[model samples]
Target: MKVGVVTFPGSLDDGDARRAVRLAGAEPVALWHADADLRGVDAVVLPGGFSYGDYLRCGAIASFAPVMGEVVAGAQRGLPVLGICNGFQVLCESHLLPGALVRNDHQKFVCTDQRLRVESTATAWTSAFEAGAEITVPLKNGEGGFVADAETLDRLEGEGRVVFRYLGANPNGSLRDIAGIANERGNVVGLMPHPEHAVEAGYGPGTDGLGLFASVLGAGLAAVGA
Candidate 1:
């Protein structure tokens, strides 16, 4: 499987995301923000970082990049797309996923090893995890809070779209402690935590996040076979 990792100006975690993909037994394809192509990769990853210096909004500018056009279209076509941190912001901005990520309730940038519970493992990006499992990964951001209207929250809960939930304590004040969410089709996912940073043993928070990449690769390969 080939997973494309997009790099926008000021993107910090694109290299880490690519390494994680390679460690997951898949080929990592480098994609540029100004490019209109996807390089024929099977899945896509929007890594974390302060894109465009987080001007105006976290992902507001990055969402308008040339590459995002293809990403939005690919996601609509059932191609798996995982967005982490600022990537999550971009996904929300692009409407590939719902809800908005705002400033942390503490009004400060937060960084720590966050504990998260696997709320729904049905999504392509999270299928490798067991429901209700707790895993720790790195979390860092200034505007990582997730918010949505009551109706949208209700729909997400009722539809089982909530993928991960904060455990122990809410790090960013996300509504209902929602750490991650998946689209209705389960093909697109957006999360604030840095799973790619936790894919390796010594370098990452732990090996707990390797499953995310594995899950997507497995799902993509299975879909092709089916």
Candidate 2:
């Protein structure tokens, strides 16, 4: 299986995402933000970074990038897509997912090993994790607070779209302690945490993040075998 990691201007974790994919036993393909094609990868990951310098509103500008056009279309077609940190902002900006990420309630950048509870294993990126499992991963961002209207928040919770929730304390004041969420189809997932940074042992928090990459790769293999 092959997973495509997108690299946008100022992207910092594309390499880490690719490495995570390779570590999960799948081929990693580099995707440029300016490109119009997806290279036919089995799944796609939007790595964390300040795309386009985060000029307009976090991921506001990068949402209009040429490559995102294809990503949006592909995601709508049931292609698995994972967005981490800044990439999560991009997903929201592109309207592929709902809600928005705002400045942290503390109004400062935060970086730490965050504990997250897997609320739902229905998404492509989270299927390997057991429901209600707790995992620690690195999270770093300035505007990582997730916000949505009451209806939207209620809908997300009611529909089981809330994928990951903060375990101990709310790191960024995200509503309902939501660390991650998925689309209606459970194919597109966006999270404020950096799972890629935790995929390797003796590196980050631990290898807990590997489950996300493994989930998608295993799903791709199953599809092919089917």
Candidate 3:
């Protein structure tokens, strides 16, 4: 499988995302934010970083990027997309996923190895995880809080769309300890923790994050028509 990693201005983890994709047994394609095309990759990853210097708001400016046009369309067409950290903010800003990311409860940048529970594995990116399993990944951000209206929150809970939830401490005080969520179609996913950072053992807490990247390539996807 060929996975494309998009690089927006000020993107810091695009290279890490590419390496994660490659390690997951897929070809990694470099995509520019200015480009309007998706290059026909099977999937796409919007890596973490402060795009446009977080001007206006985190991911507010980047939601309007040229390549996001194709990303939006591809998402509608069932293309798998994973958004990490700042990229998660971008996904919310673009209306690809419901809710909004705001300032952390601590009102400061927090960085640590956060333990997360795999709540749902129905999405294209999380199919490799066992439900209720716990894994740790790097979480670093200043505006990583996730929130939405009560009704929406209830719906997400009822539909089992909450993908990843904080296991031990709520690092950024995200609602319900949500670390990640998936769209209604289960194709687009937004994760606050940096899974890309944990793909290599020597460089991170563990290789626990590899399953998310490899999930898309898992054989069970075709059985479910993913």
Q: What 10-residue stretch in candidate 2 is worst by lDDT?
A: 217-226
Candidate 3 deviant stretches above 4 angstroms: 219-226
- Pairs that collide in candidate 3 are none
lDDT of 2 by residue, 1-226 (tens): 9899999999999999999999999999999999999999889999999999999899999899899999999999999999999999999999999999999999999999999999999989988999999999999999999999999999999999999999887889999999999999999999999999998889998999999999999889888899
Candidate 3, 1-226: lDDT as tens digits: 7889999999999999999989988889999999999898888899999999999999999999999999999999989999999999999999999999999999999999999999999899898999999999999999999999889899999999999999877888899899999999899999999999999879899999999899976733474584
For each candidate in the order shown, give its overall lDDT on alpha carbons: 0.95, 0.95, 0.92
* Model 3 worst lDDT window (10 residues): 217-226
Clashing pairs in 1: none
Model 3, residue 58: C-alpha shift (Å) = 0.7
Runs with alpha carbons beyond 4 Å of true place in candidate 1: none
